[model samples]
Target: MREIDTTRVLCSLAELEVTGGRGFAVGEGDWPLRGFVVKTASGVAAYVNLCPHAGHPLNFRPHRFLTSDGNLILCHSHGALFARDSGLCIAGPCAGQSLTAVAIEVVAGYVLLGADVDVERLANDPL
Candidate 1:
């Protein structure tokens, strides 16, 4: 994955969940990172949090993206389910369509995306 400067600060590793419940910020997006996951061994994975099925956020609530079994990402809009590892819609109307992935990396104990960036401008914007 290329770098995405707008996707910054994926949260402290200490505050992240094991099954990967986390949120971050995208300087260019309407909202900061709302629905995201952090797999301990796979770095960080992010999405627009919008379900492809009905154009709604996948999480039941902000920062809450998970299934009862914690194996899939559930779309609160229609009970659609997506495989967390691939973000592929496995059931429901969104099946086949997937969440858009945001690029990210860790540096100096911080997570940062390194694409579609205007670093100087983003630094000047409010959080």
Candidate 2:
């Protein structure tokens, strides 16, 4: 089995407090895995930046992924709202669909991508 790299750090835990969420990228070359992390009631959560509704990136503005109330994930493209912890689309165009989740963990006050995640494959085929 190939070794999974768990050392990919996304951002510091303190950073999520300022904006509620933040975006990140992993891997190299042309197609890197793009994702975001959000602060949730239980802890922290992360997801692929792609919107299931139109296959567009969820955020147009840097680190801006939440709604005005800071209660949900907002897709800037079509106003789709998603649950922070579950990545479930609760409203808008893709009501029944969901954002692809990227596994993550918090360590030493930093958020890191999960070791089991296949960053390259998930980036290219985020279904």
Candidate 3:
């Protein structure tokens, strides 16, 4: 088996305010894995930007994945509400579905992609 390096720094933990979020991309060229990171009470969580309902990016505005109160993740396309910690759609067209999680880790105050992620594959495929 061959191992592809998908590890990349998404951002510094300090960049995300508590309950706030930020979008990021891995790889380059036409297809890069698009994702976002949210700072939670326990830690940071990351997920693919694609929304399951319409298969569209969750937020039209950069780093605006959270609701006004920052309690849940919001998909602007259809008003899908998701649990920020679990990415589970609590309501909307895609209810019961989830935003694909992008494994991540906090290292030295920077958010880094986990070793298991396949950038090329994830970039080309939507779940």
Candidates in order, TM-scores: namely: 0.69, 0.93, 0.90
Best by TM-score: 2
Off by over 4 Å in 2: 1-6
Segments of candidate 1 deviating more than 4 angstroms: 1-7, 28-35, 115-127
Instruction: Return whichever of 1 and 2 wins on lDDT.
Output: 2
RMSDs, each prediction?
6.2, 3.7, 4.4
TM-score winner, 1 or 2: 2
lDDT of 1 by residue, 17-111 (tens): 54456765554555444446545335556555667776676666556677767667778778888776677788988678887665556666555
For candidate 2, the lDDT comes to: 0.90
Model 2 residue 15 CA deviation (Å) reads 0.7
Rank the models by TM-score, top first. 2, 3, 1
Clashing pairs in 3: none
Task: Return the top candidate by lDDT.
Answer: 2
Q: Compose the digit string of candidate 3's lDDT tens values, residues 23-68.
A: 9988889778899999876898999999999889999888899999
lDDT of 1: 0.61
| Local accuracy by lDDT, each model | 0.61, 0.90, 0.88
